[model samples]
Target chain A: MKPAPFAYAKARSVEDAIALLAQHGEGAKLLAGGQSLIATLNMRLSAPRILIDLNGIAGLNSITLKGGEVEIGAMTRHAEIERSDVIRKHAPLIAMAMPHIAHPAIRNRGTIGGSIAFADPAAELPACLLALGGLVEIAGPKGKRTVKADDYFKGLYETAIGACDMLTGIRLPAAPAASRYGFAELSRRHGDYAVAGLAASATFASGKLTKVRLAFFGVDLTPVRAKAAEMALAGGDLDKAVAALASDLDPPDDIQENGAVKKHLAGVLLRRVVQQLTETRA
Target chain B: MNEMCDISLTVNGERVSERVEARKSLVDFLRDDLTLTGSHVGCEHGVCGACTVRVNGEIVRGCLMLAVQCDGASVETIEGVSDSGEIADLQEAFQKRNALQCGFCTPGMLLTAQDLLSNDQTPSRDHIREHISGNYCRCTGYHAIVDAVESVAQARKGSRK
Candidate 1:
């Protein structure tokens, strides 16, 4: 299928890309990896007047670790993130979820920023970022500003980013000492979008839960943080916490499964995560 | 008005320059413009892997990429995987094992399998399944496909010794 006619502009640098975006305004769409945007275009779902390709932009594909935090360029491909030694050591949850993405071929061309920008509720990275309390940096005509993951996602296929803004990079906080993380997703087949996915991180201090963050995808319009579940588990027996956390979440009904079924799966997965973290500490 | 963009790409290790509509997909450019018809377009959308090709050393869905986007990039279609008309070991294994009956999904399957084998020379059955999950086959039910990959892996392992 042929996409609607559009103008093509390749930016030589990040600044050049931003300038082109600013000049073209709402009709402009940044092309990063072109995994999602191109698909949307082919389906005639998105008919932008101009495409600002960022592939020529330098320095946006880097993965760097400094000051105990892992900073990943927004243009970094999912394949690169999955294979990064730094991500494996510092952000295992991201690594764990990377393989569950569409497929090796899609991951090879899909960029983290592009996925985050698309903000598909069923995608793993947004929920994983929320669980890790990641920060996103955006650049626009007014320069750059940072938004927390909790505030970045607005709804399904929605984000706080404006059309004129470009996401530069994401910053994941360093893994806490004695921390255990788990990522689990239920799908009909490998590479299928998750029916329901969970990313959990727990920090233990002196054999007690110091901090716990639970995020879920495909259960809501956006990647929900599962705040009620987190509060239920705080400072309690891991087993007891799991049961309470399960009851706290309100999973939605869909063709994949009924609300009740997903809720039950959430409970089962919450228990698994809690038990896995506890066993790791033990 | 439709805009034309000049795209210079090294496709299958040969330089090709063409002026294409900005919305022209790389799959169409390869099949229609350059006349390298090895890559098939199955799902037009990114769901099916029939249009899969290697762009700058990474496998991507050619149907989902604009030809203008491939400017200065290198692409490898199924045609470039072998020099002779003879198939690669994986392709040969697929033929011998009867992995493909209709052959509509063969090119994409072969490209996707090449991606997996290039990354992990000896992927397990589960790994092979996971890697090729994006490439769907209506015929052969995947058992033969899995067997074909296993045979290729075994042969590659033996040759490495």
Candidate 2:
């Protein structure tokens, strides 16, 4: 399968890319790492009239720490994040999830921004971002603005980014003193899309769990927070938390498995992650 | 008519210039234009690593990348690496171990295995399997391929010591 013919424009700057997006309007797609976009193009699932290549843009591939946040460039490759000492030290959850994104070959070219922008319900980054309370930086004709991860993901393959807005970068708060994280995904193969997954971040205070955020992916239209399960966990009722998943998740039947099976597997992952978080403290 | 872009890039250490359609994948350009058929195209998509190649020193799915994207980049295919003897030992090990049956997946497998050995010459059997998991081989069932890679790694390590 070959991609349909399209005009390509390499943008030298974010502004240049934004201008191209504005000019092409709905007929253009921004090429980040091209891992997902290119596949869709080859499958004839999507055919944009113009491709605005953002690879030539500088300053969009750096990882930096400012104040108490780890700011990662949208164009930063997954391989870079896997090796970044800053991410490992400051945002361990993102670091923990990097190797699971894809294979080494794909990781070398897949971008963090592209993953988040695509907002695939089965992708790990969006769920991790939700669990970390991260912020997505967006740039458009009106300039730049930040959207909370909770608000950033709109639905399956949808995000807060508009037609002409570019996802510039992501800012995640550095892990706090008592923060602990747990991440796991179940897939047929190591590199295949997950059937079900969970990314959890919580803090234990005075023998009580607080600020628990459990984001589940591949279980809904978007990476969703299991609010009821989170409350149950924070309140020290593990059994209730397990049962609360019923109220929290309603996964649709997908290619990998049925909704009930995915829900059961998700519960299994939740138990494992909860054990990981609690056992570390013990 | 498809739009074309003029690009100049180094393939297998030789500098060449060509005009390609904006949508032409790097694998197609190499096989159809440059006549470098070592890198086979299996799935045309990124799932099958049959189109794996090195771009700027990192292995990437050739089918997932546009040729125009490599205008100023350096690309190394199986032919380039094989001709230069870069993966000579790996190739010999594959042959000696009978790691391939159909040979369709050999080019991509060698490239992937070489990439792993280059990173960590002492990779464990599990690590080797994981590293090459992206590259699918329907013929050998992967046991022999893993054996071949492991043999080379051990040989390289022993020699280094």
Predictions in order: chain A TM-score: 0.92, 0.98
lDDT of 1 by residue, A1-282 (tens): 678889888888778888888888889889987877888888899999989888778898888888988999989999999889999988888988999999888888899988887888888998888999999999987889999998998866878888788898999997867888878888888888888889988786566665789988887778887666676677565556556655566777876888777777777777777676666433
- Which residue runs does candidate 1 get wrong by more than 4 Å? A205-207, A237-248, B84-87
Model 2 stretches astray by more than 4 angstroms: none
TM-score of each: 0.95, 0.98
Considering every candidate listed, which one attains the maximal TM-score? 2
Give the DockQ (2 decimals) of all models.
0.67, 0.68
Model 1 lDDT, residue A170, Cα: 93
Q: Please state the interface RMSD for every predicted structure, separated by commas.
A: 2.0, 2.0
Could you give candidate 2's per-residue lDDT for residues B67-132 as a string of tens digits?
A: 999999999999999999999999999999999999998999999999999999799999999999
Consecutive 10-residue window with the lowest summed lDDT within model 2 chain B: B1-10
Task: Give one digit per residue, the lDDT tens place, for model 2 in A1-282.
Answer: 998889999999999999999998998999999999999999999999999999999999999999999999999999999999999999999988887888999999999999999998999999999999999999999999999998988877889999999999999999998888899999988988899999999997677778999999999989999999999999899889999999999999988899999999888999998886676455
Global Cα lDDT for candidate 1? 0.84
